[model samples]
Target: MLVRPSLTPQGAALALAQWWELAGLEIPDLSKVRGGNPETGLTASTIVQSQEPNLTPARLVQGSHHPQVALVQAHRLAAACTSMDALYKALDAFEGCRLKANARTTVFADGRQGASIMVIGDVPGREDDEAGKPFLGPAGGLLDKMLGSIGLYRATNCYMTNLVPWRPPGDRSPTAEEIALCRPFVVRHIELAAPKAILMVGGLTGQTLLNSTDGIMKLRSQTLDYRLGLDAQGASTYAQCVFAPTYLLNRPIEKAAAWQDLKRFAQKISAMGIAI
Candidate 1:
């Protein structure tokens, strides 16, 4: 919600100058602020010279710091990767995750830019590690069928990626430690893509994405909202998480339930008025 305050032209300009200075921005022309403060009948420039408030480091960072400094740095780095190419480069160069050591490739992301639908998988398996793309093996083939049922495909209509970009060793699920280490990259990915909707391909990805411990069977029934907190561009994302296609593949019988989930996701996409 936006609150629009009414102010006089000079008052607005004064406010603008103050805001610019507060934001550490330079304002070359300050004729408006030099005029005078509406509150005190004193010139703003004179006030700055004489009565400028001392800004201490403690005052600057007064509150709202996250508990973990490492995660904060991760968020900062993720915000820096404004473009997909930048994200790929950073993720490839990242040596933070232990999974990166043995992994043959860094599976960053695949599919079209500006894609409305984004699909997220857990981590790369053997073939995916070799190929350096998310969801391109047997699991990916199964995923294609699942999406095709709902009239979606990566080549034309979907954006596919994974939570843990580097393949986990022995085809095992990534540990919580590993997932936490790489989470910022994925969050930035979602913000950059700004996808209208998202699909989680397996339980590991589903749980990690939502920051939950629940299994897919229980989570699948609920309407899950994945909130990617504000990005550097001042844009935040609230995305819907759909059921995992790999689960559908494992238990073909559950595909019926998954189908219902897909239908719901399709309805949501249609309501958004997205083309695909």
Candidate 2:
């Protein structure tokens, strides 16, 4: 397993500046960053200026004192990627998210790229990380069956990707910070794919993308619009939430609810003149 050392506070300040320069953005006051206490004002910037600088963007990404710095870096890197290949390369090279340290491989998206329906899951599991793809193992088989039932096939009409590319250690749930760090890339992915409708599988994915506090049961019953980005170039799409295959595998009784959600999603797709 590869290990990366965490940056000291002074190292973090210097590294952040380098990252900003690399991203071609004017370096802002570090103290004013999201995680920093605004009460301190520009004190963080003052301290950064006083520190001896010696870090490159590549090495700087090993770790950071402020998580928000990493999040900003992720956004910058993801935005710089203009194509899917560029995005994948950027994500593979990105070292901001600590999850990458212990991950076997970077699990990227799979299935059709320009498919009308895009499936977004929470995070990669151990099987996904090992295979370097999303949706694998027995759960993946179930997903295939579920999609088949609705006439949505991953290889043909469906595109698939996970919110987080790297799997958490021991298959643990990803933390909020980890999700935030990877969010930009995922959003950019959706924009590039330009799918008319998105199927958000799993509660975490549904909650995060929809910005809802409701569980999968409540979330699945409603169809909502997901904004692609904050910029003018962004657009909106119809989003449907559904229970994850893995979740259904454990709770077989919930399969009925999952079926209902899939039926509703399919109906909406047809209503939009999208052929499944």
Candidate 3:
């Protein structure tokens, strides 16, 4: 296996800046990393590129077709990937999302792949961009605590992923066009994981997946019908949307209300006899 050195706090920040330049994302905070934390900035030295012959960076850069269409094609080819291995395989060949062209490695989902409780977020941030994994920065740390309060942990009982596989430029909210471009892959991910319960964490994820224009406050604290299949042949998957950790971190005062929502989630799962 090819191993890469881990980056220090300062080094990660510099690398993130470089990635932003290359990927055409804005520099949200030139001095800080995503999640708005200053301590130990985002790291990128640890990222490892895929060695697959067909998925090289050159191939991604040289492709003439729109990146979004390439991604859609990749998902279609993947067709019903039911596990992380299959999902990774599909993503490796994907050349959509310009972020992939500039990133050192693809930041895919990390955690228990077969867990009963699945959490879906918006996309990878700067720290996640460097680490090549979702939810590893300050917001992720907060998410850990929130999950712990509900007796669920990513390593043991929850599978985590995002709506878009690649980080957006400059940590911006993905555009409607961008979300629509990547929608199919996320749908495939849901089908593969087949989680008993899903927690859509934030307005972006909730709105994109649930097809709602309502804000997070209006969307939170309720169970919504979530579908996870094609129109002609898909299953009626059910899930609930809640305030994303990033939102809670920004507005700490709202945490109490967020906790109430989480408690309800815990109660629902407990009643179903699903392992927490």
Candidate with the greatest lDDT versus the true structure? 2
Q: TM-score for candidate 2, please give it.
A: 0.80
lDDT of 1 by residue, 80-119 (tens): 7779997887677655457788899999888888887888
lDDT of each: 0.65, 0.76, 0.66
Candidate 1 vs 2: which has more lDDT: 2
Which lDDT tens digits does candidate 2 get at residues 28-87? 554443245656644333333333143334543554435545655566567667889988
Candidate 1 local lDDT, residue 238: 29
Off by over 4 Å in 1: 1-73, 231-238
Quick one: how many clashes does candidate 3 have?
0
Provide the global lDDT of candidate 3 against the true structure.
0.66
lDDT of 3 by residue, 210-272 (tens): 766788888885676565554534455447677878888889999999899889888887876
Give the residue spans of candidate 2 off by over 4 A: 1-30, 34-65, 232-234
Candidate of highest TM-score: 2
TM, every model? 0.70, 0.80, 0.72
TM-score, cand. 3: 0.72
Candidate 1 root-mean-square deviation in Å:
13.2
Sort order, lDDT high to low = 2, 3, 1
Residue-level error in angstroms, candidate 1, position 162 = 0.2
